[model samples]
Target chain A: MDILKEISENLELGDFEKVSLLTKKAIEEKIPVEKILKFGLIGGMDIVGEKYKTHQIFLPDVLMSARAMHAGMDVLKPFFIREGMPNSGKVILGTIQGDLHDIGKNLVGIMLKGAGFEVIDLGTDVSPEKFIETAKKEAAYIIGMSALLTTTMPMMRKVVELLKKEGLEDKVKTIIGGAPVSKDFAQSIGADAYGYDSTDAVESVRKLFNQA
Target chain B: MRPVLRFLEDELIERIVSEARDVLCKLGVEIHNKDVLSMLGEHGAKVNMDKYHVLFTNEIIDKALKTVPKSFKLYDVLGNQTHDFSGYDVYYTPGSAALNILDYDTNKIRRPETSDYIKFTKVVSGLKNIASQSTALIPADIHEKISDSYRLYLSLLFCEKPVVTGAFTIEAFEIMKELQIAVRGTEKELAQKPLTIFSCCPTSPVKWSDVTSQNLLDCSRFSIPVEFIAMPLSGFMAPVTLVGTLIQHTAETLSGVVISQLTNPGAPVLYGGSPAIFDLRFETTPMGAVETEMIDCAYNEIGKYLGMPTQAYISLSDSKQVDAQAGLESSMGATLAALSGINNIAGPGMLDFESCQSTEKLVLDNEICGMTLRMLKGIVPREDFPTLPRLEELLKEKHLLISEHTRKYLKEEFYFPSSVIDRANRTRWEKEGRVTLIKRAHAEVEKLTRDYAPSRLPEDIKKELTKLMMGEARRYDMKRLPEIEI
Candidate 1:
């Protein structure tokens, strides 16, 4: 079977070992990195997402396949990046000030990059000024803010205040989120958008882009 | 009539509060972590020159406790809000699952981005059973520095019900404000009342870190009803006995309430504790242990008795995952919580002894919550006492009421889950295809995600968001790359 086909199939099956083996073979054959990334890896993930969309796959299966994809990517990581530049997208991500929990935010970051968004992760405990400054410096269009603490949930709103006060809110479309954050809060805070799950965020962005 | 537990006495409330203050004030809760000592000193608590502990008298606590609000309001999607959380009208606070997607490209695990939330919201917005929505796990923005921001935005679009969520940094808070405006169309309307968020201070009986203090200040200033979750690992970070543990929990929780209210008086606060004991055997805190349940029950009683709305971390277990242990522990935990009449139940789908979160477990726990609520409904009368002639005629020499027209409503009158639990007989089940509980749950989860189409977002807003994201990519010197063909 074609190596790409094998790799994609293994990823579909959530077989990490097979993915690794196929990855090695594909690498030995000197398969193009871009092709494997798109046709093999990304393709497999898309299928997994769709499968998840339906009843064809579940969390454990997705986790297992993603793990397998990780193994295969490890072997080819050095080569892919060394051979060429790492894939990148423009993103500005950070946890709101006074808040430090990031499991949800971090997960969003991973999915963003996987979906081909260039990510700029500002570590947690970030402030409003810091976000504005970074967004300005990077000229980032989408500024992502996350808060996991109820105490800090308001800080996500403060970032919006800073942006508005600085006249940066319009220039940068700010998106806010966390366990306690809601669309109502997002709108009241004057943010561009809010998301519930990581994947839904990705699709929302894509939809936004298409509409734009 | 409900069985009243003696733990709910008002005298006990007064005693416990006083005792907790005395212990902290006199003994000055030990400076277990040096860093915490510095933070407390910085935060206005007077530290003895020696810095072994910080002395705060009963007066200070009394004064601080005065700032805590009894309740706050959360506006609904229709603009209606509720100050009380004990409506007993089940509200949705985001699904209890930690969903992750691996970036095969990056070979790293990450939370999904905006698109993830958009889909979820479409479903959530449509869910009548859900009282509120969550910022789930997606962030709304795309940050080349970290990850995506879908979870953040979807909280705006999904359920439209009040959201249960938090922020990681101040800037994120700003975006959250903007998103609220986007959803509701006016920041002024959004700010008319307090927005509640559950911010976690570092596990207490341990120490309050600097950031944790900052988080408190942040929420207090914004008037976000804050639920300070005080998690103390017993026998490790806390005391070995239940009484000692309660004292420790009281100190920690009271301290947070004081700080938050002081920062902003009348700011709503809810007292909560997820206090559990370490098994010593597994070297892990068994969330399923009866002791854990007892501690929660005791703490909840004390808090509510104090005239504060309470939050309890219940419906959780010590199991590693969703299995028999998970079922047993969750059933007991949820039962204790519902019967105890806890205002809020956290860690519903938490598994692996709270080490991890699971989607499967969340869906299953939702079912459990339903069942538990039903159980709390107490027994109902079958009306078979007299064996009336009419009913006997309907039964007519048969032990079954199969021919009774009223029987048709029996299924509707009773609630049944389609997955994760089985009710079919051996032969029917086998014939229908012997599906395992987990497998059935998996199927259910898939169906939910697939069919879930929450509320919709305005077209203009979506377009604006996308334009910004792509522009951000270009600004970061990123390539548009190629299209992902389905």
Candidate 2:
């Protein structure tokens, strides 16, 4: 039996310690790094993502499997970086400036991670300048912002303007969400898209990549 | 003609009561207040002072149960006896201490001020089915330390009906008593008339805090009727099963009864509860959930079995707004509690998980309470069992709309809805601008508040009441209290 097949089995089963040890064992066994990343870890996570979409698994189950996939990825990441980073695009997520609410943004981050996107969480009370700098430094393709207070919703527009000012508007798409964020507000702010909830945010991010 | 609603069989009642007694004797209850421990010890309870747990034997519990008066009258502002809270009779009031009011016109949720209390009381006074008053809104503008006293003061001034209100601190409790004394003339007369039923709650998981325990003692000493509300959140503070939760409720309520009796024999107390199932998903005690209604009905059954006057927090909705969910949950709870023969049904006009109040909901629940009362009245047997004469009359008429018997029985037998409920014909309804229940209720509320004229207090007593309240305010360095135009 292939060791990567066993790694996929353990990853799907959500056994993080076994996934980590098996990935190390596969590396020692002279398995190709791309096959381990694609056929083993990503393959397991793809099944989890489908299960999550179809309601076969819930948030807690998806979270556990994502954790297992991360265990395997930790062992294989150095090899992938040397091989020029064979992975999905990056997404920078945060609550907008002067807003201390990050629960929605954190949920979107987890779902994005489960769907194989590398997410950089900037946390709450995040300024627009910090979001643009991180997107440029990480070469991220998407910037997602959340604000639970209507008072702080205007900060999302500032981030979009900063992206345009830095000449990264064409390269990066912007998405906004939260209790107060609406489609009309998104349009008025000139955002690329608006998500009603975290699940909708995942679908919108996937659509953005599909268009690219 | 009112049909009694009973849920428990004799055998099951006996079983639950016996189990509760066994729990009290064996498991005991934790009382953090040393004075309560001493009081229970003096009354023959096996109190372990170091452990702060007192074990009540069957003899002690029976003695305490006997001391509580089975019936009492709650008085209105004019010193007239209002609802007789005894046996199967039930009264309705809005839930208290809501932090915000839903501005119906603006469709905005904001903190309620002293002005909102005036409006709330006026609406409560106008509604016929809302039998009592509660300081429903805890104004955000008042000083936090004196807010409870200020709420009672406002209730005494604006409300014509007796209030279902309480105190937070010992000073607030004394001040509330002073306010009641001002209305009743003397402390003895106030105790005899009982303008308010002070509510004291014991913290869940079988622990009594110092403040609530002291309140029990004060209520006993003052001879004021007290409502012992034991709220247990199932699966968290209490057992997850309904039967287990009931056992805990029985034990906690019985413990409070024992304390009240020991403080002063024949201290009037009402057995009441607002137990709810803990929602593990949201980590909230959803009071409007169906399981909560079931808990209420089941506990009231135990209360009636003990021959105790019972109160249940019902008719409260968990909806954040006055939407369909609010109507459904509120009506369901009101119906269930009333049908279960709860004596004092206290939860109406409350929304957003009991943290907010709305005037529209108050008027809406007035209709619900009327319907519930009618349902509790059941089918009447005015004549003999045969009904041959009525049958013949019905057959002869074919249409009983204008029959003499139909006209005679119309007001007595049926529940008549007021303007808040829409029952007009389609053509008339359309011609009337298709008025919604909310719109009618808003109009009713506006008219009620605008037309309200409070019972005038004597100048000297009014000044005395103001001076007493100001004395407390001065202690807190509050320069200005909310002015009252009434």
Q: Pick the candidate with the highest TM-score.
A: 2
| DockQ values of all predictions | 0.01, 0.00
Candidate 1 TM-score over all chains jointly? 0.57
Q: Please report how far candidate 1 places residue A140 from its true position, in Å.
A: 81
Q: Residue A65 of model 2: what lDDT?
A: 78
lDDT of 2 by residue, B1-486 (tens): 666655667787788778888888998888888988988887788999999888888888889878777787888867899978787888898988898899997978899998898889888988888999987989888888889888888888777789888788876888889988988899899888888888889888777888889888898898888888899988999999888888888888888888888788888778898789999999988889998888888888888778778898889998988878989999999988887878888889998877889998898899999999888877877553687877787676433443446655666677766678886545346646999878988987887888887756666776777788888888899998887786
Residue-level lDDT tens digits of model 1 in B107-140: 3445655554454454445433344555555432
Q: Which segments of model 2 are wrong by more than 4 Å?
A: A1-212, B381-407, B456-460
lDDT (0-100) at residue B119 of candidate 2? 86
Docking class of 2: incorrect
lDDT of 2 by residue, A109-146 (tens): 87788667899999899999999989889989999999
| Most accurate candidate by lDDT | 2
- The C-alpha stretches of model 1 lying farther than 4 A from their native spots are A1-212, B1-13, B27-54, B64-67, B78-83, B87-130, B135-150, B185-188, B191-196, B318-320, B380-413, B456-486
